[model samples]
Every structure is written in structure tokens, then in C-alpha cells.
Target: MGKMKRILYFRHDKIGDFVLAWPALAMLKRALPEASIEVFVTPVVASLAEACPYVDHIILDTGDDKAIRAQIAERNYDGIVMARSQVRTMFLVRGLGVPYVVAPKLHWYQYCYKHRVNIQMGEGEPVWRKGCRLTERLLRDNDIPIPSLPTQYWDLSAERPKWQAFYQKQADSQLVFVHAGTGGSSGSLPTSHFVSLIRQIHEQTEQPCQFVLTYSGEERKLAEEIHQALADTPVNVALAPPLDKLVDFAKSLVAADMFIAGSTGPLHLAGLHDVPTVGFYAARRSAVHVKWQTLSQAHKRLSFTPPPGRRDGRNMALVDVDLAASKVAAFLNQDQGK
Candidate 1:
């Protein structure tokens, strides 16, 4: 540590994982204001990182070892940090030959880092909080002063009006955004559960709510299933507009009055927007409420498992639809009063 001039951080993962790393990245930039900080992210989340104020540059992880090495070698970063650890990323750090690298000490790859943050998985902290703590420890070990970091960070000011336009169409009606399709990270409720939830919301809210079913390319059928099933309901299940970019997808969330989903990328995105949300989750230790829950106070998580001890990950449908509907309705009402 002779006052590092440049740093590169890697978090080549999904949108949600990249979002969770925001606090740590912000802290790093705050602590070292003069240092050039760039992020190496997957193509899926590159645009989202581009919107972050903390990141000075965005390096897309092309997954080509030679290309990555060449790109990194050119940067000549003084330090590298892995917000989400991966063996390939470790090798990338090694190949670049960055003088100082920091990462969690949870894996065998700890030997490669000049600084290691000893952390246990599921240590009673949200993943984002864990990321912040890890970055803090890394900086502390290197005698770098820590700076304040926000609990959440997303620059939606430019897009806020754009999203507000979408919501304004509903006027005083509550706009509830629902994502029934799971991103394969955690268990998902059955399509029927979603259909039932929508039906219940319409009844409970007395038709004062509009519903939008957000889905990915692979989840079109699931979305359609709910749409078709609710064909006769007074509430219309509109499909969200085609979202081809992560930044656009995130911007679209600003229009939401409330969001409903399982533990997924969009759910996490809504949390960043401070949207009231309700999520469903499976009842496994790793996927438990505390670990995978949304990081928003105006949110609710309904965790369910068939036998409480079952870990097969097939119990998302077991989440009581009526219970979820009631909670979601309550959350929306709380926002209504404000």
C-alpha cells in the first residue's frame, strides 16, 4: 500500500448480485477519491453498472480468457477486489498480476489474495451488508480509511419521470407490479398461485388496482399462463413492455407502486427504488427469509416449506396464496395513505 492509484473490482454475475455490491463499491470510491475505479461485470449487468455513480469505467466480462487478460493488462490496476468470488475471476486477477487483490476468505482461493476477508456464509447479515463489511475489512487491513456508504444506491432521477408517466396512466389506482417467473436462483410459486394471487388482489382491493406481469424471454409462457387464467377477472393482467437491457428493466421499476415476486433480480431492483414489495421464498437455510429477503422496510416475505425441514426446494407453491394476498394488499394500502 503506497496509496494505490487505480483499482478494478469484479462482480461478473446476475443483476441482483451486481446491485448488492453497490454499497461496497461506493465505499471504495469514497475512501479513495483520487483512484480510478473500474468494474468488470457480465454483459447482462454491464448497463446497470454503467448507471452507478461510483464506477468510473465498465469492463464487460467477455468470458474469453485471452481477451480479459489483455483488457486487464492494459489497465494495470494497483488493486483488484472480488465482490462475488469465483475461481475464474481469481485466475483473471492472477493473470493481470495486480499487485494487491482482496476477496473473501471463504474458499481455497484465499491464498491468491494479498488481503483476505474472513467471512462465513449465512452469517446473519444480508448479502449486501456482508459485501459492505467485507470491503470495509479489506480496506482496514490495508490501512485505508473507510468512508460513508449509502444503504441503497440507484440513479433513477433521469428515468423517474419516464416511469412516473407509466404509473400516471393509472391515476389514483394502485399499480402493483408482479413477477411470477423465477430467475432460477430460488424456488418459484406455481403459475396457478400467481393467477390466484391476482384474482385475490382484485377482490381484496375492490378493483382499485392494476396488475402487470413482468417476465423474461424464458418466462413468457408462465406470464401468458397467468394472463390467460385471469382472462375473466375484472383486473387486467398486462405484460410488461419488452425489456432488452438491464438499465431499462431497472428504470421501469420506478413506475411501480408495489412489487411482488420471489427472490429474484427484479425484486432486488425494486428494493433499490424503495418501492413497497412483497416476496415469496422457500424455507431452506440458504434461501431463508433473513438471507434472501428483499432489503426494503416496506416489504414482506412469506417463506414456506412443505415439512419445515425439507430442503428439496419444491415448496414455493406451499406459500399460502391467501396470506400473501393479504400482506400485499396491506403493503399497498400503507403506500396509499402516504
Candidate 2:
């Protein structure tokens, strides 16, 4: 309660989850300016947390009980906070015997299970931000300093030139980025849908709307397919670079007139950067996964209401490509008017 000299924050999730946890971290740092904050994150998102200024150290592990126990045993942490509410994470921290531990109570899980919807619309039911709110409440109840909501935190000044370079290579015309990929996950829009959408956007916006096909790793295949499909069209399609150069990629997204993507990490990034985004919602997951916070009021969400029982898959055809292009064009025109 007095001061947390040493603390541990645990988040075993994807890149988007880590990014969402930024708000909580910022609150903690503000409350305990001198506290040495360490994070236990999944290896995939470890680098992102390490990049956070509020985090002093990052413990990269997959939230395994033995690994967590071993890591805690080696460190003399004064407080422990788990952003994730998995049973394994709970037991691991409880076993650590830390003097001050923060986690949601057992009852909060029941509440979450009852009200939560599967945002991914994949295998099981969705989890909502309500769980995160519960976790933050628990931390506050335990006398830990909570952080503010996660917003955009970037050194854009350093990234401007990189973005300009990418933009310069683009055709001398209006450019729109269509992000149809998720972060190495199954809950993404179909490639066919993306290709169809891009083709439609090109026809509607005959101004040679360059298509920035942002993707990574194995997902690059999807981008390539989109390029091949639009080979004859005036639209120019290109894949986003590797993860190490994400700052530049993010900068490019911010500079774009409009972004058309599915509910994913980049959507949140776009929202944070004040980029007008048109998100294609897959279903129940899409409803929950889409960015709830937007720096710009002009952002739009084009959700597809999947048929009942078919809610788990990308079955909805509620948003047509023509509508999406119209929205993007309107958003860009509004920006120009400003």
C-alpha cells in the first residue's frame, strides 16, 4: 500500500491483448513511479511489452505453471498482478507466496462466463473487456496502483521519415490500406472476401487507389493472392514488411486516408493513430473484437451479422464492397474538407 518497490505483471495472450494491457501498465507506472515493473508475457508478445517504457523487464514464458513458479522463485517480487485470469496463472501467483498479489476474485470469473461473448467467433465463447475491468478492480481493491486506459503510445516523430518513404513509393494518387489478416490467428476474414472487396474498391475509386496488403509470416500467402487477383486492376497491392519494422508500418497506416481491415490488432493501432478505419466484423467475435476506442470520430465499423448458429464462422455478407468503398471515400472527403 505504501509503495511497490518491485512488481510483476502477467499477460499471457496475443499481441492485441498485450497492447490493450497498455492502459493498465500506464496507470501502475503513474501510481508507483519508482517501482521496478516486470512483465511475464507470452513469447509472441514479449517484444511488444519490452518496448513499453512503463515495463522495466519482461519475463518471456507461455504461462506454464512450472516456468512461472521457477521464475517467481528466482525473483523477490513485492507485488504480483495478472492481467490474464486463467486458472494456471492464478495458482502460479498464489503459490509464489508474494506479500501482495492482485487478481480477480473467483466470483468475477463466473460473472465473465455468464456475460462474456466469444469475440474471436472461433472454437468457444468469447471473452469481453468486462474481464479486464474486473481484473483492474481487483488490483485496485488490493491497494495496487492502477493505470489509465491504453491509448496510442508511439514515438511518431522518429517514424515520420520511414512512413514518408513508404508513401513516396506508392503511386501518385489516393491510397487505401486493406488489412485482411489477423495476427497468426484463425479468427480472420476469408481471403476470397478480401480479394473481392479490394476489386470492388478499385472499380469504385478509379483514382488508382493503391492497395497496401498488410500481413506477416505465413499470412503473406494471403497478401500474394490478393495481389495476383488484382494484377490486372489499377490497384497496387503490396505486403507489409516484417514485424521488426512495425513502427514504420504503423506510421504508414496513420498517414493513409482510410483503412479497411477486419477486427484485429492493426485496427486498434489505426484507431489510436486517428486513422479513419472501416472494419469488417465477422460475427459475435467481430462485435466484441472491433476497436471500441477511436481518436477520430469519423471511423466506421461495417459488421456482418452472421446467421444464427453460423455465428462462429465468417458467414455474414452484410457489408458489401461497394458500401465499404463509399464509406471510405466519404471519410476521406470529410478529411479533405477539414
Candidate 3:
């Protein structure tokens, strides 16, 4: 029952995985303000951990077993939480012999956790909430009071002004940011669909609306194709800055008033910033609204999927661009209170 000094947490996954773990990490911070919570994350999402205020420290997972063991032994953490469980991580924790370990019981290495919570991954509960449950189970087992759920988490106050100043030129116009690439996680809309969506947003709006297309370096071709398709339209089209650095790319999302993306990391970033967003998704249960839904407020966000029977694979691409555009128009107008 003594005050725990240091706690180790694991979420060494992709950008989207870490994004979904944000609220749970924030909950841990709030409930045990005195504990030094350090998260082990992959290099791909280290920037996000650096940006997150939830954890006191971030340990990069370099994939070297010896190095990882040395780091863990030196820290002498009091407790550990495996939010995103992996066999390697379980083996590492077991070898280090951390006194208190917690993880979801759904994994193959459930016995490795000293404290395990039954967690199910499906439409029944969000992935983020599942993380929170693991944390809650750990706290309850130790007689600690659980904190309220976190709806969103982002430290953008410092960066928002910079974005505002940079986008002041188009201050009069509604900024509609769109990401045409899906990072190959789920289904993506056709390049022509994005082009049509951008044009439709422009045509449906009364005032000027500027559109920015954001993409990864590998997705430059897709961005260029969307840009080329918009050539005949009056709508202003600009490519988002290089996203080589995660923090810089995160800052860029703050300047946008509205964002359109598939089930991806950027959509979660927009949700964190409370930017009005519209997300496209496949009809599959895993990809539907119940599982990959955004944390953004209902009034500020929209989720679109194909009809019940057609919701599968590339079926999301069949989501009528004109219909999706109409929904986007309505959502933006509501934000304007028009």
C-alpha cells in the first residue's frame, strides 16, 4: 500500500495504436499523480509520447533484448501495465521480474501478468476504453480509486497560435483538410473521390473554402493525383508539409477547421484537437463506427460507411462521393451555425 515510485507501461505499436491509448495513459496520470509513469513505445510513435502529457517519461523500444533488460533493471519500476501486449514484451517483463504486472487476459501470455483483466476486442468496446479497463483493473486490485474517463488529450495550446498565425492568410476561408491515403491499414477512397469531395465542398459553400491534402512521403503520388484532378476547379489546393517528423505533422492539423480521413492516425489527431472531422470507414465490424470511432464530440464529427450488406473491403470506396460531400457540407454548415 506504500506510494509506488515508478511504473512501466507498454504501447509500442503504430501511430494509431498509441493515439487510441492516450486517454488511458491520461487516466493513469490523473489517478496517480505522484507515480512516475514511463511508457515504452516504438520509435515510430516516440514523438507522440513526447507530445503526450500523461507519462512522466518515454522509453524507446530499440528491439534489443539486452538493452531493454538493462534499461528496465536500472529503472526498478514498481508496477507495469501492458496496454498493447506482445509476446516479446511479456517475455521481457517476466525476465525482469517486475513485482506488479498487469495486462489484458485476452493475449496468449496472460499468465505473465500478476494482475490480468478480461478484455474483449470488438464493436462492444472501443480500443481506448479497453486500455482504460486494464488500468482500472490494476488500480482497483491495489485499492486505488479509479479516475473518470478521458474524452480527449492533446497539448496544442502552445502550437495552436503558431498555426493560427501561419494560416491567417486564409482566416476568412474555412480550412478543409483532407487525407487521401489510408496508410494501408483499411480501405481507402479512390483518388478521384477525394478530388470530387474537395470540389463539392467548394461548390456547396458560400464563402471561400481552402483545401489542403496531407499525405506520407510514400503517398506523394496519391496527393499529386488529387491535386491534378482539382486543377480545373477554383478551390485552392495545397499539399501538407513534409510529415517526416510526427510532432510537426501534429502541429499542422491544428490549423485546420475540418478534416476528412479514413480510419487512420490523422483522424485521431484531429479528434485530439477537437477539429470538426468526417471519417470514412469500411462496413466490416472491426472497421465500423463502434470500434474505430473518433473521440471528437458528436456535433463536431461525422462517420460514414456503406450500407449494411455492402460494408466490406473496398466497399468503403463505393461510398458515394456526392452523398459524402453533402454530409460534409451539412456538418461544416452546422459548425458555422448557419
lDDT for every model?
0.75, 0.60, 0.78
- Please tell me which model should have the higher TM-score, number 1 or number 2: 1
Error of 2 at 227 (Å): 1.2
TM-score to native of every candidate shown? 0.89, 0.74, 0.93
Candidates 2 and 3 compared: the better one by TM-score is 3
Of models 1 and 2, which has the larger lDDT? 1
lDDT of 2 at 172: 52
Error of 3 at 165 (Å): 3.5
Instruction: Report how far residue 209 has shifted in candidate 3, in Å.
Output: 1.4
State the number of backbone clashes in model 2.
Answer: 7
Candidate 1 regions exceeding 4 Å error are 95-97, 298-307, 311-313
After TM-score superposition, what is the CA distance of residue 130 in candidate 1 from its true location, in Å? 3.6
Cα lDDT tens digits for candidate 2, 1-338: 45557778777777666766665566666767887878888787655676677789888785366876888878888776655667666556655557666555454442332222222223332333533464465456657656654345443545544664666545455556777676432246667778877776666553556667777666678788888887886666776545465544555665565676764577656654555666665545334433343333333433332343555445545445556556555555555422
List where candidate 2 sits over 4 angstroms from the true fold. 62-67, 106-139, 142-151, 155-157, 167-175, 182-192, 199-208, 241-257, 269-274, 289-314, 336-338
lDDT of 3 by residue, 1-338 (tens): 56667888898888888888877788788889988989999998887788888878988989897788788888998788888787888777776757778888865678766688877775556667788888887788777898886555774767766875665536577778888878445577788888888889888876678788888866779988999888877879887756568877876787788889874788887888778878887767465665776667667768777765633445766777898888888767766522
Better of 1 and 3 by TM-score: 3
Residues 137-241 of candidate 1 have per-residue lDDT tens digits of 768877998987554566465776677676454665777888887755667788888888888887776438878888887887888888888887677568777
Model 2 lDDT, residue 158, Cα: 57
